[model samples]
Target chain A: MSQERDTRTAFMEATYRALCTHGYADLTMQDIADETDKSKAALHYHFDGKDDLFREFLAYLHEGFAETIADHPEGTPVERLVALVRRVLDPVDDSADQQFNTAFMEIKAQAPYREGYREVLRRFDADLRTEVADLVREAIENGQYDEETDPEEIAEHVLTYIHGTWTRAAAVGADVVAMREHLVDDLLDLLVDGASVPVDVDATEDRGLAAADPDEPHENSSEDVVDPR
Target chain B: MSQERDTRTAFMEATYRALCTHGYADLTMQDIADETDKSKAALHYHFDGKDDLFREFLAYLHEGFAETIADHPEGTPVERLVALVRRVLDPVDDSADQQFNTAFMEIKAQAPYREGYREVLRRFDADLRTEVADLVREAIENGQYDEETDPEEIAEHVLTYIHGTWTRAAAVGADVVAMREHLVDDLLDLLVDGASVPVDVDATEDRGLAAADPDEPHENSSEDVVDPR
Candidate 1:
């Protein structure tokens, strides 16, 4: 890489580390400069301010994600998608990634009140949905998935599950990798086969069975359907 | 109610509101006092300091959750459990609930660094797990669910999902109720019938196939279990 490109990479890495450690509220440009072994002026030349730096950082992360997806080997779409999830959840050195996750969430929390931030987040979210949806679409086209599957809804579900795992893991001090593994397993299970009902009920009869009183006799109910045994 | 009981309730409510509005770092005893229209001396008499006030607040919220579960109607375990989830995602005034959710996350973020805060969170998580686990166990006992289900794991999954939705909704300024409904549907789908695989593969064949192609293979392969196309 060119010297300029190398310097920018170093600055981005340093800023990411610092933001993770100190949080967005406490991070400073001087700290990034010191961490990157660059002068304050040099750091300023590359970025306008903290908000600018954060925007660039987010872009960098997005690019990294895109590269990860691009690098996924040709396979059944489900396999590649699972690999994508495993890669994202893989452990990194120190707790820097955790900090980054927290900082990202903090920024998201402020997005509603900050229009620029909201736009950034909205674009990022849309990008994520698009990427995952494409993969789902590929799976469907390949015939690995059922014809009735909805890629957009599945994408939303997967992304929501991932974010939820991260936030909950952080909240409870649980191992992110373990929680993620369990979550991915659950998600894959839902996607591949779909939900099953244990007791076979006639569709018309069972429509609102759960909504009715268990004590109330169903007009069409039989011992077999009720499973009284 | 007794005058002392009313005063204590007033003090607690005021402190909860203050913490929600101003956050932990900016909240003060004087603020709670002013909000409650009580003297600082009276506040001190009720609680020792900011720490004590927050500790009490945590306990109150925890107790409220317990009360909600207790008040769930008599029915099958699944119905009761669903009610528990609905109550957690209850839509109060968004203005107030948003502040509460924000404060709740803020305190959770700090739990790792503060022993007192960590203890409160630990207790809260443990209580939730126990309550949910018991419900799952009851369901199994009554044959409402399969015998293979692990209550602890299921409880963890449920709690993780709920907490995740709470933070994600707050982050995006979305309607929490709608988020909860979507989550519940997805979760129920997963639990009612275990995650389905597109096709059942012979275990030994699947293992060898996955191992042989560490990198996903594209298109037609001898071991391609589910034909995508």
Candidate 2:
């Protein structure tokens, strides 16, 4: 049993490495087999086929994402929330998280009809939200947030933005780093208890800096905010 | 050319019905063929395979979603915004929009991996955001929203929530109607310029109504919000 477990772990690790290297659509069985010392027969013996391997891989991915919640970075609730958002939304790495997200979303988009995908994702998503909710609840208790803030609602809101960024980034192939830095991360800033929403800050800051990039959205002449058709 | 167009329309309509009824994962060529008088060979002839058929089906879906933006309903910007939100987010019926969204998201989930799916989804998504941004811009110009409002960010923010809700709902069977009424629609409310964010209101209401569902996360006692570790 212990030997079998080692083989399973090896295959799982090999699958991850191959997925990251080759990507989901282009990934081939030999790609994963290349990472492992095991022969293709050994790999096939452990998993019936690609979908079977992917199912286990999906489970493995959940464990990794769920740990982000469990690891619970050290900081005040707001700081932790920032870290969580950065971990989930910000593209701090070259393509690790982004690649995972795009692939994860590709699989996730199938959740509605694929019961297996649906179940794993449902549990993992709920856990992630609960983690976020706990943080918001802690913030409120510590008085970082007003007593009136709803942990569930705020958790859902923040998760919504983070997840939305994932889906959009995956779909549109945007410069996520710029989008997050210049556009997205501020959503996290908005939740810092008494943090100013920066609704007007961008407009005023950009106007005086007239040297600001002309193509950027969010801040510009009100007349130009939406082009007239 | 006209004969080709008719055959294409018939296949698209059949695909829509088949997807809504059987869903994406279980969608078989036979299911679509059953919907139309044409033979399965006809569908195969029109498109190379499932991917090709789905590509055209996606274009059809975009035209449908894009029309919502083009067919701007007559009303105040706020009313129009609400109507737009309702059109996009609210599950109007069992089949029309919600079914399309669920099936559409299934295909979209593949966008992260499929370049063809990504391109079409990106274009449609950009157009949708532009529509929302336009509405916000008009609201600002009409003085419904403060001049300080950033149309692009606000549009992205709103679109993020809508898109996130769709993904979440697909992953987990959710009471979207309650969530929309209680959560998502309120995000729209925050955009009403001078309107109050329900952050405090929901908490206060939930606290007063203490009879609110115990399983509900935000409104309960702080102790209840997080299960004592």
Candidate 3:
């Protein structure tokens, strides 16, 4: 059983690499095979075809995303929320991350025609919405947000912003860095008392803003109070 | 010249009907031809292939969207903004609108891989952004919004919400009518003095809200003070 799980992980990683390189429209099993030690026949033995492999691959991607959202449980509700947005939107490396996002969106666009793809993408949306809603609930309980604030509404708004930013970035190569800053600021300002909370995010953290071009104007410079590491 | 223009309009409408039916991924010249009085060979005579025809099709779609945005210039900035959101998100018959949206998003998802699609989509984004920004500027000039308010920022945020809402509605069959109501309320409350703005949207207008199920609860019913038309 352990060996089977290991092989599945390997194939999923190979698919990620291949999809990032070739995108959804042109990706093939042979292309994914080139990224792994396994041959095309090995890929065929494990999954029925590209669609079958992609269904599993999308679920695998969602697993990673859900785990990332769950990993930081030690912060205030606002802090954790900011951290979650960073994990998704932080341009760790512009090219590879942007490539994956664009390709992933291409697959999502096909959801209307593909049941397997739609099911997995629905899981992604539901999981993210629930997690964000739970955080908002916690924030309200902690008195960080107003008692009247609807956790579900805030969750929907936040998720919509994230989705919108992703679509624009993928389709038109929009400046994601700026859009992410707006999200962070909106959360800090609207959802909570901005001055009372410590909204700092570490520059050297996984988002890799420390690697961003130093010359570019960072509008939300106040949020970068220190390297919290 | 007039005859050529009429032929283009006929083909564009035919392509729209076919795309709304077959969607972007499986759409072909034969499929498009079936919707038209013209033969498949006639479609080939006008355009080279699927991509070429779609390039023209996308531009045609944008032209219609642009005209719709420009049509309602007589209302208050806030009213005009609400009208635009309603036009996009109001569920006329739900099924047909949702089908077109899902298919449209699929094509948008391919924009990263197809420069022709990307160029046309960029035009859609640019034109919409400019229009929204200009409305913001108008509102600010008229003392409806704060003098310090950033027009460009408001425009980006509004556009992001629209794109995000479209993506969710397409992928998950989300409740777009509710999402659009939130947008209208946000525009009324945040951008303008909500009490002063007569936020009336005609139910019998092009948005076709009168066609919606009457049993559903309308949360922002206060905005429905009267239908002037």
TM-score of 2: 0.74
lDDT of 2 by residue, B1-229 (tens): 6988988999999998888787675688888999999999888888888888887888888898788667655665644665566566655356455556677666765665554877778777788779878877777787665665567766666666666777766656555544444333343333433542222233222321011232333232233211131
Candidate 3 off by > 4 Å: A191-195, A199-229, B92-94, B191-194, B199-229
The candidate 2 chain A region of ten consecutive residues with least summed lDDT is: A203-212
Q: Write the per-residue lDDT of candidate 1 for residues B1-77, one digit (tens) a residue.
A: 99988998898899888876776545789988988878999999988787787777778777877776666555667
TM-score of each: 0.73, 0.74, 0.84
Highest TM-score model number: 3
Clashing pairs in 3: none
- How does each model score on lDDT? 0.60, 0.61, 0.70
After the best TM-score superposition of candidate 1, give how far the Cα of residue B71 lies from its true spot, in angstroms: 2.2
Model 3 Cα lDDT, one tens digit per residue, A120-218: 888887888888889878877887765655667667777777888898988777877677766665555434334234534332121110222322223
| Candidate 2 structure quality by residue, lDDT tens digits, A1-229 | 6999889989999988876666665677888999999888888999987778888887887888887667654566645654455455545355765666665665665555454767777677688789878877776676555565567766666665566667667666655544443322332323333543222333222211011232343342133222121
TM-score of the candidate numbered 1?
0.73
RMSD values, in order shown: 14.5, 9.3, 6.7
Sort by DockQ, top down from the best:
3, 2, 1
Clashing pairs in 1: A142-B228, A142-B229, A143-B228, A144-B228, A189-B195, A193-B196
Going through the candidates in order, what is chain B's TM-score?
0.75, 0.75, 0.83
